[model samples]
Target: MPESGSVELVWLFGPFAVYLVMLGVYYVWEGKREEQLRQRYEEAEHGQ
Candidate 1:
């Protein structure tokens, strides 16, 4: 069996690692969405 400390470390970091990955993805998605909206607004204004 593995040592007690090793198992504890995995359990602690596993969820944290997943959370960081998800946060990064969310941040990138929001940035792209915001950029798209800005471009559309600019196009509409210039067209008017």
Candidate 2:
């Protein structure tokens, strides 16, 4: 019974940990994308 509980706990938190990692990756990707867009916009404005 204790082994079963331990396995269940790991199963539950394992997916949660994966989700947190994905969220962190997504957050970083978004920040980088925004920075790139801002730079492009500035370059376009300066070229005109």
Candidate 3:
């Protein structure tokens, strides 16, 4: 690890942080799309 006052930590963690953010956005979007499709077909929550 570099010194506290150095910029190495940002370089190391930046890409990982960006990846996590993108992953979260994708999951949320996919979930919403799935819900819309399920509702369009009138599917029950528990298959009842």
TM-score of 2: 0.83
- Between prediction 1 and prediction 2, the one with superior TM-score is 1
* Reference-based lDDT, each prediction: 0.99, 0.97, 0.88
Clash count, predicted structure 3: 0
Alpha carbon lDDT of residue 34, candidate 3?
Answer: 94
lDDT of 2 by residue, 8-48 (tens): 99999999999999999999999999999999999999999
Q: Which of 1 and 3 is the better model by TM-score?
A: 1
Q: What ranges in model 1 sit over 4 Å off? A: none
* Higher-lDDT candidate of 1 and 2: 1
Model 2 scores worst on lDDT over the 10 consecutive residues at 1-10
**Per-residue C-alpha lDDT of model 3 across residues 1-48, encoded as one tens digit per residue:** 668756777888989999999999999999999999989677665566
Candidate 3 TM-score versus the reference: 0.71
Q: Estimate each model's TM-score.
A: 0.86, 0.83, 0.71
Worst 10 residues of 3 by lDDT: 39-48
Which pairs clash in the backbone of model 3? none
